[model samples]
Target: MRFLNFPFLVYENILKHLEPRELLLFSFCSLKTRTLVSRMRHTPTYTIFILDKPEKMSYGFVEKPEKEQILLSWTWKKIAMESENLDNRTRLKLKDVLLDCRVTFHRKLNIPTLVCRCEDVSSRKRFATALHSHMCEVFHVKPEMQFKLSLDYMDELPYTNTVRDVTFLQSSVNSTVADEFFEKFHVTRALFSKRCVPDRLLKHSCKFLEIKNLFVDWSPWLDITLLLKVKCENIMFSSSTSVANDAHLIMDNFNLEAWDPEVDKIEYDEPVHDYCEELLYFLYDIKKYMLRSGILRRQSDGSRALDKTGSYCSS
Candidate 1:
């Protein structure tokens, strides 16, 4: 059909009703048709996976809350699966089909454009690194898409740069993998659950080492310097015994004097009983020291810091 021969408004109206998979096919008809499809405004809000295996290629999708249906090709050309039912693997120049999908969608769609999902076949497992490397060399994959790993691979990952966001299967990985991932990606926002923060996180001084936010089980063995380096803010942990020691460490080298009072906020899960008493005695002289140089006023340190009856500020 001569799709481009229609009136401009009519062509657009027709194109808007078509799903992304349909638009992809429309784009392949001709360069002119592809250009028209690319310029369309409405974007589909659906996720589609084009499954390809050594012998068959199939695809499927789910519109928002619907269950994703998997479809397979019985015969490539005789009884090919429709776009409404595509799922994984490697048929066609998959890299090109994927690139064209991105192009026709004008690079905006609910679905993350798949480069290669062909990890393994029914009874045959292809070399993953070789396949993925070839895809990277040929196609341009957007870094924003999440790479849902079968497991947080223990060995060194090859295409680290392409993986921006990662989701690990539960009980399938350990802190070592998470640590390695953080060290490599240096992703600004990161989360680690059910695992202890590893030593690799503390020792590295990489520019990417500035972890803006982190969530992990607190261990007393953790070095206090790591918290300072990670720039953790307002996070509460229940190590009552270590607060006094940590308070002293903070006062000595964490440069609490230079920190902006209005901006920096720190919280402890434990009460301020032992920590307050210990910190007050430690700070009494340091407060006097800061005031002696005229950096802090003596009146500011007068009774509030020295008083033992009140809450945080004594006097």
Candidate 2:
């Protein structure tokens, strides 16, 4: 029992030393330990997908001292769902610990990339609401805490139940729906604060719009261009149909250059809401000025022109 006399910080550090997977199991043994582990895991962790590596080397091989240039070891985070084995007492303890940990270590929680595949918009919205409610309650915070909740969706719409901030939704569903959803739900100015509007939108209004990235591929979106400026890192036009052929004439459409990520300070338009200064940059913007220049001439011999008018704007 004397060991229990040690400071909670000591216990926390010990748990921090455990592998992430191990922490999940270790959390079950006691109320205090579970709390410590939960606090340690709140901050978002990151993972970078690597497409190419040396054929003969494993990460361990690269780390071996024999190799002069060692590749950095990689780490990532995974979220956990409720497990039924824990009794209500243990469950309550775990939840309490997580709540306390979230507040005590607010800056440490990892922003998670939520992979949602729900086809129903209502279901997705419900999920966001549930996620928002649980986190806010667990942290004993207000709805504002939802801003800190960052997510990334793989092949899923950004709006499931509703549109929330800082969540990335990637999907093959028609871009038309995504465009409409953002117009209906997301705050354009709040988006601008994070520099969320892309240049294509800026060119539309001829004002400085901040965006990290933006995408529009259908007609209804054109209606909201006035409200949809983003200072995004990337701007994508999935289908030019959104802007009528004549409208495209007046509008400076986004190209690969639209993909370049925006780098700027955060600023919000409203008085009550808050914003986060991103501690890191994860996505890259790709700009495609040439493709938007309206010149479609190719060489007679089937080779792309070696040179054409360079980008008219700066990324």
lDDT of 1 by residue, 207-262 (tens): 33344333333334344433443442212221213324456654654333333334
Per-residue lDDT over 30-59 for candidate 2, one digit per residue giving the tens place of the 0 to 100 score: 665545555654433211111122111111
Candidate 2 Cα lDDT to native: 0.29
What shift in Å separates residue 125 of candidate 2 from its native position after superposition?
Answer: 7.9
Where model 1 places Cα greater than 4 Å from the true spot, the runs are: 1-5, 18-33, 42-90, 94-150, 153-171, 179-225, 231-245, 255-315
Quote the lDDT for 218 in model 1. Answer: 39
Clashes of 2: 57
- Regions of candidate 2 where Cα sits further than 4 Å from its true position: 1-10, 20-31, 38-172, 183-315
